[model samples]
Target: MTVYVDNARIPARVGRTSGRWSHLTADTVDELNAFAAELGLLPGWFQTCKRKCHSTLPCVHWHYDVTDKYRSAAIELGAQPIDIREMGALTTARRAALSARPKGPTP
Candidate 1:
């Protein structure tokens, strides 16, 4: 699975970090997490659910929000740079995969 980093440089502050941030995502969650480890990213830093993670919803978005430093490192580490359209396609595919996941007993 190819890892992709978007060109989004939105200004933000996470914890003590303050800088433009980009998204580091992959074609699969396993690959994303594995690559994140290579980038020295903590498992806690991984973002999947947008709102409450405890919510009984399929978390389709799996990515690491990388600051400028991490973004640069990601690019240097061979993460493919992608555009907004590419991101949309990726998200759509992820959502579809989520929909296809085998479901358990409905509460």
Candidate 2:
């Protein structure tokens, strides 16, 4: 996701400027909740999604808007910055493969 850093809150969504989904850093549920809550976000909204890395770290996935805002706050909160993309082609290719897969093992 493309991180947008600003001192004030973002007021609108603009095309092209908006970023893509990216992974999170907080490893545990508690860490995730604490971080999100600090930014005035509810715990329920913190979605759990797949990450390319295998780690105990509580990786989260958020839409571009949320990611941009949260990433900024994270930077101010002494969180490290990372640049990445979920890869559109990977998602599309994976979806197509899944759709082609059999519901169950062939007899």
Residues 1-107, model 1: lDDT tens digits: 79999988889988898999888999888899999999999999898776743335567667899988998898899899998578878987777766677898777
| Backbone clashes in model 2, listed as residue pairs | 27-57, 27-58
Per-residue alpha-carbon lDDT of model 2 for 1-97, expressed as tens digits? 2222222233454454455333343434466566657666655555545664233333233322355656666677655454433333333444455
Which pairs of residues collide in candidate 1? none
Q: Give lDDT per model, in order.
A: 0.84, 0.46
List the candidates' TM-scores in order. Answer: 0.81, 0.41
TM-score (C-alpha, index-matched) for candidate 2: 0.41
Q: State residue 51's C-alpha deviation in candidate 2, in Å.
A: 15
| Candidate maximizing lDDT | 1
Q: After superposition, how far is residue 49 of candidate 2 from its true place, in Å?
A: 5.2
Q: Tell how far residue 57 is off in model 1, in angstroms.
A: 6.0
